[model samples]
Target: MLNREFIFSNPEVLKWIDNKFIFVAGDDWYRRRAQDDASVWFKSIARKARRGKNGSTQQGCYAVTPKGELLRFINTSDPKKFTVTMLEALKLWDGVVQDKKVTIPEMKNFDYKVNVPPIDPSKDVLIKVQSRALTEKDGKLERWNSNGKAGGKPAVGHLWIKQAEWQSIVQNFKTMEVGETTPLTKRLIHRIAKFHLIDNTRGEGPAWESKDLKHAKVTLTRVKNGFAIRGMFLLTNQKKSLSHSTELSGEITINQSTARPVSWTMIAYGKHRGEGKYTRNARPGAQPLGFTFEFLPASKIRPIDLVPPQHMRWQRGYWEAEKH
Candidate 1:
C-alpha cells in the first residue's frame, strides 16, 4: 500500500519507470508455480532475489533484461532506496546487449483460471474496499503504530456484486414501503462477513470460515434517496483466538426510474483480534479495525482495479461463500 501511495504514485518515479521500463504487475501466488511463459520468465528473475527460489515469499522489485538476466532486486518500501536501485539497474543495462537470437516460448499450458478477473466491470457492480488498523490514542482513533513507526498503509480489495443479485435488490426495493426494512440474503451477508470484512491492514488475512461467522445480518431500509444499510456481525475461529465484532452502517443512492444503485457507501468499524499466518505482528489484544466500502464507477476503473479479490483464487469458494 505504501509502495503504491508513495513510490508508484510519485510523478518523477513514474516518469522514469514509464520512459525506461515495461512495468508488469502480477500476483505471486500463481506466478511462482504456473506453467506459462510469463510465469517462467517471472521465476527466472525472482529466483535471483535474496529470498531465492526456496523462500515462502519472493515479493520484491526486480529489474531484468529481455533475456531474463537479473540486474538488481530490492524489497524495501522506501522510495529513495528503490529509486537508487532502479538507477543502478539502468546503468547495468547500458553495459549489456540483448540476445536477438533467443526466441520467446509459446504459452500452451498456462493456467487460465488464475488470470481472469472476478467480475465484468461493465455488467457487475464493483465496490472498492479499504481496511486499516487503528488504535485509540488520547481518546481519539489514529492509525496504528508498530514499534513507534507508522502503521502499514490501508489494504485494498474489491467486492463484486453480480448483476443478477443487484437486480434482485432493486426489485426488492421497489416492492418495499417507504420506511420498511428487509434483510439481505444470507449468501450476500456471509460473503461480506467472511471475505470482505477481514483485517488485511498489515498483510494477507485469511478468509473467515462459515462456522466462524457466528452472527451476520444486514438490512436495507427504503428511503427517499435510496436505501439505508445497517447491520452487525460477529466472527471467531473455532479456538476463539481470532475475532472481529463489528457494526456496519451506510447509505445507497439509487436511480428510481431505472431501479439501479447510483451510489453505495458502507463502513464496518469494530475491534479485531489475532492474525493470520501471513499477517502477523498484531497488537497483543483487541484493537480497532475498520473497513470502508465505496461504489467505484466503471469509468474510474484502472488497470490496478482489475486485480482479482485476494480470495478470488478459489472462485467457487469466493462466490458461494455460504456454501463453503
Candidate 2:
C-alpha cells in the first residue's frame, strides 16, 4: 500500500517509469516456481538480487535487459529511495545498451494456469474489491494509520460472478414484486463469507474454512429500477481464535430492457479480530474494518486489471468454495 500511494501514484516518478521502462507487475509467489521459460528467465535475474537467497522470496524491483541481465535491484518501500534506485538503474542501462545489442527471446511453453485470465470474460461479471482498516475518531470512523505508514491505503482485489449465478440473480429480480425480498443463493452467500470477507489490508489473510463460517445470509429486495441488497456474516477459525462479523448493504441498478445489472455497489463494515501467518499484528482487540465492492463493466476493465482472484491458485476450490 505504501509503495502504491507513494511511488506509483507520483506523477513525476510515473513519467520516468513510462518513458524509460516497460513495467510489468507479477505475483512473485507463483513466478518463483518457474512453470515455463519466461518464469525461468525471470528467476535467473531475480537470483542475483539481495533477497535471492535459496528458498527465500525474490520480491523486489529489478532493471534488466531483454536477454535477462540484471542491472539494478532494490527492496525498499521509501519513495525517495526507490526513485534513486531507478535513476541509478537508468544510468547502467544506458551504458549496457550502448556496448551490446540485446534481442528479445521467443517464449515457448508458457504456463497459462499460473496466471489465468477471467473465466469467459463475455459472460462473467467483474467486481473490484477494496479493503481497509478503520479507526473510530471524533465519534466517526476514519482510515487507520500508524505513524504515517501502513493501513492508510485500501488493498485491492477482484471478484467474479459466473454466468449462471448472475443469470439466476436477474431472474429472481424479474419474478419479485416491488419491495419483496429474496435470499441470495446459498452458493453465492457462502462464497463471499468464506473467501472475500477478511483482513487483507495488512497482507494476505487465510481463507475461512467451510466449518469456520458460523453464519452467512444475504438478501435482495426488488426496488424501483433496481434492487437493494443487505446481509450479515460471521466467520471464525477452527480454534475460534480469529473472527470477523460484518454487515453488508448495497444497491444494484439494472438495464430494464436487457435485465442486466448496469451498476452494482456494496459495502461490508464490521469488527475484525485476530491475524494470520502472513497477516500479523492485531489491534489489541476487535477493530473496525471495511470493504467496498464496485462492478466494472467490460468496457471499463483494463487488460492489466484482469488478474485472477487471490484464492484462485486453486481454481476449483475458489469457484466451488461453498462445497469445500
Q: Cα lDDT of all candidates, in order? A: 0.82, 0.82
Model 2, position 264, has a per-residue lDDT of 89
lDDT tens per residue, model 1, 1-324: 434447787777776777787787777786765656677667767877755466367677888887888889987767788889999999998888667236766756666676544477766888999988888999999987665333457889998888888888888777888899999888789889989988887678889999999899999999977789999999999988899999999998988886666899999999999988877777878899889999887789987887878888787888888899
How do the predictions measure up, each by TM-score?
A: 0.84, 0.88
Weakest ten-residue segment in model 1 by summed lDDT = 144-153
TM-score of 1: 0.84
Which tens-of-lDDT digit does each residue in 1-324 have in candidate 2?
Answer: 544447777777777777688788888877876477878888888887756567569887888887777889977767778899989988888888453566766877778677554466556778888999899999988988856655556888888789889989888878889999999888888777877898887778888888998888999999988889999998889897799999999999988887667988999999999988877776768899999999888777887668778887777777887888
User: Could you tell me how far off, in angstroms, the CA of residue 203 lies in candidate 2 after the best superposition?
Assistant: 1.2
